[model samples]
Target chain A: MSTHTEDTKDIWLDECFAAARQDTTAAPDDLITKILADAGTMQQEFATQSLVATPVRAGLFARVSQALGGWPSITGLATASLAGVWIGMSAPAGLEGVTQALVGAEAVIDVVDQYYQAEFELAGDL
Target chain B: MASIEELSDDALLVMYANGDRDAARVLTLRLTPRVFNHALRLLGDRAEAEDVAQEAMLRLWRIAPDWQQDQAKVTTWLYRVVANLCTDRLRKARPVALDAVEEPVDEASGPVEKMQDRIRAQALQRALSDLPERQRQVVVLRNIEGLSNPEIAEIMEISVEAVESLNARGRRRLAASLSDKREELGYVDAH
Candidate 1:
């Protein structure tokens, strides 16, 4: 082993590096088999999760709810619909009185008469 | 669906996480060689290097579901994992079996050049092993592995300046160590 000048030293180092880079060592076949085996096991685990964890297809109502904006919005719409149905079915006791107070009976009669008069005029024109 | 070769590593990992067995195969084919080589260079023991590569890949498989694509490149993350695994093995200083260090065959060169290349490679490995761990890592990543200094810094979790300093010191040491062997390594004859 003899020492080289600085210029030679750089060239030698570069040569050595180039040689080392060229010396590519593949992972052993058995090692690759082991790695792939492990990956296979993980794949199975992932498969199991896919099978059990995620639904294949969301239920129709669930899909609709998700499209509309998830459970919160669904719950809100449900509550509003239920309230509307209750209001329509049960007609709370002071509702008519409240309506009469808000709009006099004469006002209601006048509106109905005006509606019938417009219908009669349209029929005559036809 | 894109073929495995057409997909990026990140995409392969995502597919693997989603239960695509072929994706796992593709990823293993792509990354195992790099991991094994890096580990072998760091540990200087074939069996241990294989173990390190396997363990590192196992961790990768485990973390696939949670892997954040924007966070790190897959190979970079594997390099970091292998480096840490090598560090832990070095710290433990386990007695490597005598048969564990197998010389790699260089099929690309003719017999004589192949022999010479092997010798030079062994000499460089010896010099690399003699370096301080950080310097060795920096030099290997920079010179042999052909990674940029910033990439080396990211893998080693050090500042780029520190990585540069380590690389300089490591190369200087390697040059000093191998300078005397220039003739024996056929550097003079080749020149």
Candidate 2:
């Protein structure tokens, strides 16, 4: 039985060694050269495109308009609107965390109400 | 010894990122052939291999700026990319009959030896195509590309034990497939 196991191991090892031998075939030389050439052309095109993309400057009237949501005199209202938008997005998380706190407060009120009921029952006996 | 004359992969990547054309040339010179060969073995098609190799190299060119320096060398990353791209092409490719092996042009080998070699290459290629994709990749990485288990694991995104299991299973299946040709495979003393 031991010899059988050893023989199996040796055969498997031989098979692995046979599979380990490597033979290769490469891409033609001209194709590699052409790929490089194409890459170079792409690089030139990318460099040229990046040079033309300067950030656009906002004009004075546009800047003010943006700040006030297009209002000239009701800037306070715009500020309030901005605050509303911010709160709408940010309020849910804070509200959820406070829910657990409110739950604790409710439990305290229930305990106090029960304590008063117990006192009333005891007073009635007195 | 590491040569001072050669720019490190990271440095070359930085240059390529900054739109240095020479950097692309240097990077291509370093990466293209290995990537091509890797794609070739996975797909067993020359044209597809070149396509995969080109796209992989171009993607490297595109990603150089964002690449972290401490990560694997740019070339190893390219090999992984090329392998995946070959896998993708293979999926999209209309199934073609496996190509016949061409006789090698070596002058000294006698005709009988050459014929036997051709037949063996053909049989092995067939058996290799028979392997499951993951197992085939493991075998190729271990046997053909000569990558270590850790390297294969990293590229395959599997644990080292998984790599070991895959290689063991793959090699066993491969040997079984080639069992009919044991004598011709020249495994006379392999056992």
Candidate 3:
């Protein structure tokens, strides 16, 4: 086509397209409501799937341990408790020496013996 | 922090997938008109277009969970969905009665301009409806929708070359058809 013809063609088509472009139809209210309803229904499906997929939460002790610093801290506490138990059961000789160093020997030994006796008597009653 | 309205469509979609009701509302309000208008243009019937719009959005909602943010854009995916749905409807149904297609009325324009624009729109719609499906899709997206050639290519799953070619051919076809009615359309003395 000649340039003039082409320009004319473009002008008319451009006008028509321009008119069409100005003619956007807003989505009706019912359509929005229908889509929102679908979204709500699908959200329920997502909720259900999430509930099923989510792993169970930690128990109280596990949570507390986690708060306190998880397995490494728990392990340290367990070790200290076991050491205390061993000392109470066997009264290791080195503990007495350490106690003697901390406090003068005579007074510390007398009080320590009395405490151990009372603890033994209490254990017997139990 | 940006309001929900300011969030990207991809972000809103991700939020919707995670059961965010506000995200759903925002996305519905934001995307529905665009989807509906595109459907109306392609299908050319209000009720059917409404149905197509609702169905397309439903697909989007369903696909939200599986949507790969890196792979595709939300609007592109939605446009492709609308196009496919329209193509399916067009293939299964007979041609739409042109009278059933509502010409958008502008309350702001003068009566003479309104009628002229209506006639022009109706004439354009008739010519568009007669176009081949691919050509119509190309023309509507390129001209009416004003999408970039690359964007049209991605939406239609065609090369940019194909988009340009279809766009040219479609415009030529539309021009040829409308030229016969120039005197009736008021182009005879207008310019």
- Which candidate wins on DockQ? 1
State the displacement of the C-alpha of residue A123, model 3, in Å, after optimal TM-score superposition. 49
In the range B1-191, model 1's lDDT, one tens digit per residue, is 76678899999999999888889888999999999988888888878899999999999999999999999999999999999999999889865443454566565766888778888888887777778778888878887888887899999999999987888778888888887888899967644
Cand. 3 Cα-lDDT: 0.87
Tens-place lDDT digits, model 3, residues A1-126:
011233234676687788787766778899999999999999999889988999989899999998999999999999999999988999988888998888876763354588789999999999
What's model 2's TM-score?
0.64
Candidate 2 C-alpha lDDT tens digits along B35-137: 8767766776667777888888778766765788998877668767876887787678765465642222334456675555545655666676678778878
The candidates score, on chain A by TM-score, as follows: 0.45, 0.31, 0.44
Model 1 misplacement above 4 A: A1-9, A50-126, B94-101, B108-111, B189-191
Share of real interface contacts recovered by each model? 0.72, 0.24, 0.69
Most TM-score-accurate candidate: 3
Indicate the docking level reached by candidate 3: acceptable
Tens-digit lDDT string for candidate 3 (B20-63): 99999999999999999898888888888899999999999999
Residue B61 error, candidate 3, Å: 0.6
- The TM-score ranking, best first, is 3, 1, 2
Write one digit per residue (lDDT tens) for candidate 1, span A1-126. 122232234766866777788787977889989999999898788778777988578799889988999989989999999999998899898887887788875664454587789999999999
Please, what is the TM-score per model?
0.71, 0.64, 0.73
lDDT of all the models against the reference? 0.84, 0.69, 0.87
